[model samples]
Target: MPKSNVKKMLFILSKATIENVYAAFIMANGARMEGIEAEIFFTFFGLEAIQKKKLEHLHVATVGNPAMHMPTMLGGLPGMEALATKMMKKEMEKLDMPPIGEFLEILSDSGCKLWACKLAVEMFHLEEKDLIDDLDGILTIGDFYSRATEDNTQMLFV
Candidate 1:
């Protein structure tokens, strides 16, 4: 491709939960690997993925999610969310996958732009101190769109 034809991507992550955040990380990593100029905009629930206070509290679903089936009785146990999340992290470690925090860090280091939505941040009462240090800045929807409108830039809402 010509220099001007380089691919670009704008990832809008609207869900801050574990599964969704992981998906966003994977997509950003993949886009970077393909030489795309990638930007990740965290909004609404998605902001949780990048928030220092809530990042570790993310959980994996072992019950209601059809893709995963924990032992029926185990599913209803009191500490199920914590247990499932721990188990999932262990599994990921066994596969040599990076933890979510480190994954985000790697992407940020590799030139992926990370932004938090200003409106969502205010709505959630989140200050800049609440967000992970790697965020480039906070932006409005219009600011995000202005950057996303570049040629060959793909926008994804997760």
Candidate 2:
């Protein structure tokens, strides 16, 4: 593989579904493992992953998700999302994947920064206390942009 020039990764997560959140988390974790600096900016529905009360309760978004391979109507039925999420979690557990909260802690302890989008936080009427203890802070887009002062920094919207 060619050596990567990228030294930093900035992820903007805008969805709350377990799949979307996991995508960001896994990429950030991979970056850290590769000695790259990494950060996640939680925005829109993605803030749910950071919310103290909601992170553990995140479910797979079954409805209207083509990848779920179920009819939209069936996916929207009561308990369908829960059943899918439960099955996914069981599979994750079998692979020794840590739960959301634990994954956040691991990322934090590994020096990956986690930030909540200020606008989204305000829109949701959430206080700092409502977020995980590992959160670095809430930031505006400008503030987040400033963090990429070095060369070879990459931004990704997930």
Candidate 3:
């Protein structure tokens, strides 16, 4: 496709939780597969989704999240989130979806850009080394705004 025809998409991830991360990546990869330019900007708690240590441990919230359908009381039970995470992973496997680690590699290989927030890193006491090595690097909100404000860029805050 020509530069004049490229479609740009920006996904803003604000939650550190599991379901949100999955949704963001699913959308980003879908856009890339459709020949649309995609960039996922991780800010605030969303940084946790990219952290090497916590990324794999991400679990969908069982409660307090309106979509999960579980009672709020059940969500507080010990090990419930872990159990939910396992269930989710199992379902993903059945669907042939790659694990989180492999999924990140897929995004990178597919030309989907990944970036973390500079302010979030400082506030969370995290260094660049803490995130996946494939990252494009930390981007300032100002930087994101300028790019996202460009012509034909569609921004979605997940």
Winning model by lDDT: 2
- Tens-digit lDDT track of model 2 for 67-110: 99989999999999999999999999998888999999999999
Model 1: pairs clashing at backbone N, Cα or C within 3 Å? 16-45, 16-46
Candidate that beats the other on lDDT, 1 or 3, i.e. the better one: 3
Expressed as tens digits, the lDDT of each residue in 60-158 for candidate 3 is 788787666888898979999889889888998999988777888999999998999889889999998899988988999888877765578888999
For all candidates in order, the CA lDDT equals 0.86, 0.96, 0.86
Residue 136 alpha-carbon offset, candidate 3, angstroms: 0.2
Q: List the residue pairs that clash in candidate 2.
A: none
How would the candidate models be sorted by lDDT, starting from the highest? 2, 3, 1
RMSD of each: 2.9, 0.8, 2.8
Candidate 2's C-alpha runs over 4 A off are: none
TM-score list, all predictions = 0.87, 0.97, 0.91
